[model samples]
Target: MNFNGPLETSALRQVEICDSKLTDQLRLNAIERSRMMDSPNEEVFDRLAFLAAKFLQVPLTIVSIVGDKKQFFKAAHGLPSPYDVSREIPIEDSICRYTLQNEPIIADDATKHELLKHHPTIGPWGIGAFIAIPMLTHDGQVLGAFCAVDTKAKPWTEDDILMLKELTASVMREIHLREKISELEDESQLRDKFVAAISHDLRNPLNVAKMGAQLLSDMDGDEEERADISRVICENVDRADKMIQDLLTASRLKAGDKMPLEVTFGDLSALLHSTVESLQKGHRRAFHFESEKTIDGHWDFDRVRRVVENFSGNAVKYGDESKPIRISVEDHPESARISVHNYGPSIPSDEIDNLFNLFKRAQSARDSKHLGWGVGLTVARSLAEEMGGRIEVESTEEKGTIFSLHLPKVKPSLH
Candidate 1:
């Protein structure tokens, strides 16, 4: 009768701590709204949920959103109606309520539970086995549940749980991005409407600031003051330029217009040394390079350098500033390898899978002083793949972190 034993424990562990009453209310409201939406719609979300359930080979799948009143089925498979017969199950009895509390996929054999054994859906419909995963927004918002049910008892593997969770997370990300795009669209429209008004109002003030700074530089009252003014102007201009570049880069990347690779045989050691030297000048971190053997490999030198720079910069920014960043290169007859090692806090095991994902960052990175847009690793990995190489990271809380790049050694064609 106790199907809740392992299921409840697994689900409870994944629960995110939320103290804000307003946030809780808003989340519940969103769930309710999502649940009311019907299936087989034009919306991409419905198709995604349906595909996820089908791909997982589940008999009954429901995109269930948990609200304060009831668990609503936004999309349902192997069910006659869009809405469940019971609009609201007591939160205590709701399996998805458990999912909302935990991060893992909650799978239970309901045949053993006296409560679920006699339940309306399980008893009459012959639906006993249940599996549910929490669908989460990028900012860690538990939006709803993705679940599958069957009449027969089935054993669930850890891989099954992880795969379902990953699928649900992917769906949630797409939904979140769509919502963001909608919001941005509205903002863009409003900006267009008031473009002339805002521009006219701000242009004079900005021009005055610029002219005043220039006048101060020409006056040369005090050398230090002149330098300070010039620095402020330059810094502001640089900030603006960076913002523009970021926007352009994002657009290009989304459009799959990243720089193309032109692989050629080159000395990786020289390129790595140059990168280290350049980084050392900007960041006051000791950079050490070592090579077990000289390597001439076929690769996009610029792309490889970018990867090295990214890792090195990350080490200097996130690792212990006083500790040295070490670069090592090794070459085999068939392959070449490069590793960047830094003495930093280990990345959590849970985050390793997401490290290379676009816009994904470790929790430690969020809490630390290191600032980034979280796309560096993703870009590096892509570049590596383009050059027929792979990048991997190894880390431990005690030992530190090492990022390694492996590439195939190119052999010259006989003429």
Candidate 2:
């Protein structure tokens, strides 16, 4: 009821005569944090207060977390006069700081105990007797206290602390259980999304192949036209197979599969020429390649080919169709680099970091009409890293976008 702002700790002490009476602000902050990690369930906390109120025979049982400037009532059984078990009380007007900072308290009468007699709540709320146990985490952070209070003077026993301690354990157990359940539920949702993505990605190419097959069957054309139809069918089939292979490769990667040096070694120049030819045949774009005559590498040719195809495909998809997409291979003693460049809208620097993650697409690509499942770069990065190589990207308003893949020029020995 109309909780005011920042009730200065001045109410607790006057002109700071002695410092030992100070509250443990650190422990109080810890208490605030421990409560924030879990969702507050009134029913769960109410049960604690109910149990405490019944066993201790106190009219008021509150599960309190001491905050920076106020005491939060997480759960309460019976509190009166402008309050119940659920209200914020300024720390300066609260007496929780005593037991919360030190050992548990068993105040038989507030008037007798010097520490709590002058407390703002003592005369107003009639807090005659107080008993609280610190609700602690495994690492020993005092979250708050479970306490019982009565209006008339009373006595608290050792057995009361034990009972309250057991109850604190019960409440903490529920908190831990709820937190773990939330994590598992979140993970299950992510798994479902992964399955949906794989299904959609695989289905797209399969649908194209099926349509190509249907068109082929209805054909009554010359050899050239028939060959073109066959090419369409073949390209679709290859695309479908590529999607499946990406899934397979991703699984292997997850399972710790590695590519040996021998597997990656091949003719670098020839692969670039062939990959570009295959891509250009299907797309309405010009492809240009420049490379050393006799390039050698101990790199996974197949993996590199996937990266090349993805990079070149992105170029054609994003670049000016009237202009040419260029592929350049530079050979060095230590390594060889393949760069795919396209004239297109630039990608922002912040977006490049997450570009290779599975299911993550650059904002530029998402905004464009060209759509993809966003796994091609994922495969590319995996393959490159496994082969002891790296992939890099650069984009600008002037030169457009360029993706460069670096691989060892010479193959490593198995031994």
Candidate 3:
């Protein structure tokens, strides 16, 4: 049952071979990866195994690490159980071990290989031809073996082996990426929990402060003192309310349980005008509204309004408050587009793909003083998609950034 290291070759022969051909490091690394897969959240590993099986069009695919006494299945796609065999067979009987020792991939005709001619599992399971490729990490450690098994003795083409190897490489990369994402999700959840606990504890004191400020203002005293105390309480209350709203929005968006949309025909011009006027009150930024060709569409008025407000608020907070924020409405026969442009540093190319993910914000936005919980665009995107519309963002260093919302136009009924 002991699977010893690769057989010792002559010193001169070993010295002549390239370092990349060495199998000792790869085998040990695969053992380490197999142990890591024993932890919770191994679904990512399992998914990769399944993809490998599908890509190779094989009935069985396994991510296995061969130990001294057993071959452990870290991830198995076709097999029903995680541990298939009770103990490891002889090293000469291990196809994967031989595959790793002799190049990256190995395939043998079951009928031809003397070592596998009498294998119990191969004959009993009707397995004829098999292939195994080493799964290597970026550091040149073999994490495990990516293997595919078939029941028929069909000859495998060179292309088949090449494709399987490519798939194994992709699976290795995916496993590494999934690990990183899991770490980030854990960190984000911890931060969210801390914020929630702090907000909950502050709520009681905030309510008490509001009540006390109201009572003091009602008492006969200097008018200036009463006004100032009332203003202080109001400002604090508004800040608390904003924080609560942001948290609620993030939660609802994540849960996918926000209010149902009630779509109706609406004039974009009037909506933009009213939204701008309301957002401008008490705000120092100048607002410029423009329309090209009368813009009209059938949309959820309230939801669309919320999207507009979110964009405007973001512009006011991130863009220069001294300059004007421009809102443009463009109408076409089939669709109407609303764009909010703000002057600010351009967003990074990498973050654009993930900008709509829950709680994901661009790096440029992270340091902004007026930042929210990073849920505005996420919610806006979900709402827009539900209403059969699309949202896009474009940014440039010189021209600044623009967020565009496009919705379908309402057509007259033929009936």
Candidate 4:
């Protein structure tokens, strides 16, 4: 959305038309990659747009992504339509076009500004003052601008531009994060297909390794050394097989494949405690599991166990070893709540939203002594959602980090 505001300046009176810039084509190309054309308002963008309007104390504000000839409003505040209705305007009528080509702009009186004076929006839209900051991509593409508008002439302070620039930066980061996630999801889908194809080819080789190890165990030999070697070989084979299976499942989930869960009625409490006990045997720290009684649920027992391992493993690896990792299973009327809480540094607010993003880790996690690819939560969340439930996360300096998951207690019967 294009905007005009009460804040005016003499700086843009004789400014060159935005079209005079040769980089318009490259800028348009990058804007196209954002996929914002004719898109509806997003909450993230809307918040910043409103913040820009209120902070500038202007009558209008907009977050626009400019394309070849269209200005698409990802969000807007105080904008009345056909501009709002269409959520786009011709680039010719968009003052934001200049902000893309050059530096951020200000026009104290649009009626006297050279290139903008005779523009189509001035008289009808009542453009008296305007200001904008460029929305830049990481690779240095100017996508568009976060702009404010007024219908009456006024002067704006340097602080106004600074605040708007900050808001634009915030909005651009969100936009870039969104684009990154989308790109990763698409890449994951392609990778999943490739994994599925290769998994089939590798299955026979894995079977041979397992069978060979088993044969060695059965053959006549010095029992002690032979048995130990056999056991090591079998263990490694099993581990490799499990890795393949996990990769197959993750790929399928990322590719939006439905899980063929072998659901059964079972006790979630028993499952959690048993898994923790097994892990505690090998893990360096203590695990405290709390459950008053059995909480029965119809779930994929294997999948639930996997989720527990992922959460518990992360806690053991990253959490303070001196503190016990806490896991609790509680029953809700229609669901079972399973939570894993670990004592550690709080996850930053900026990184929380990306916590479950595929192949992404909290910056703190990356900076810590622990290492991970950050796909566990994404997989866990998908499994929870597939089972007609959801996962939630909370972190605080005092309380540490907790991953809470609720799953439906009843599974719908399938034919």
Number of colliding residue pairs in each model: 5, 2, 3, 9
Cα lDDT for residue 123, model 1? Answer: 56
TM-score of each predicted structure versus truth: 0.50, 0.55, 0.55, 0.52
Off by over 4 Å in 2: 1-201, 218-221, 259-266, 320-322, 412-415
Q: Rank the candidates by lDDT, best first.
A: 4, 2, 3, 1
RMSD to the hidden true structure, all candidates? 12.0, 9.4, 12.5, 14.2
- For model 3, how does the per-residue alpha-carbon lDDT over 1-415 read when each residue is reduced to its tens digit? 1212232354223223422333455455454543454444377768877777777687888776654334556667777432343323343345554434334544457645443444445565466778778776666555557778877676777887888788777767776776668758765895685466546645754985678676795789688877766765765565466456656766776676756667777787888888788666535478898986556677677767878877887787788666799998888879888899998778877678677876667777776664445566777787677667889889888898899998777632321
**Better model by TM-score, 1 or 3?**
3
Error of 1 at 221 (Å): 19
Task: State the lDDT of candidate 2 residue by residue for 330-372, as single tens digits.
Answer: 9888888999998878999978987876666788888888656
**Which whole-number lDDT from 0 to 100 does residue 229 have in model 2?**
71
Best by TM-score: 2
TM-score of model number 4: 0.52
lDDT of 1 at 53: 62
**How would you encode candidate 4's per-residue C-alpha lDDT over 1-415 as one tens digit per residue?**
2334322454343234455542456566677778876776778888888888888888899988877667788899988967778888877677677765547877777677655665667798888888878888887778888888889878888888889889988987787888999888886874665455455545655776677677785788678977666655665565455456656667787687876678899888888888888767546478888997988879887778777777877787777778999999888888888899999788887688788876667888788865455566778777777677788888898998888888889995442
On lDDT, the stronger of 1 and 2 is 2
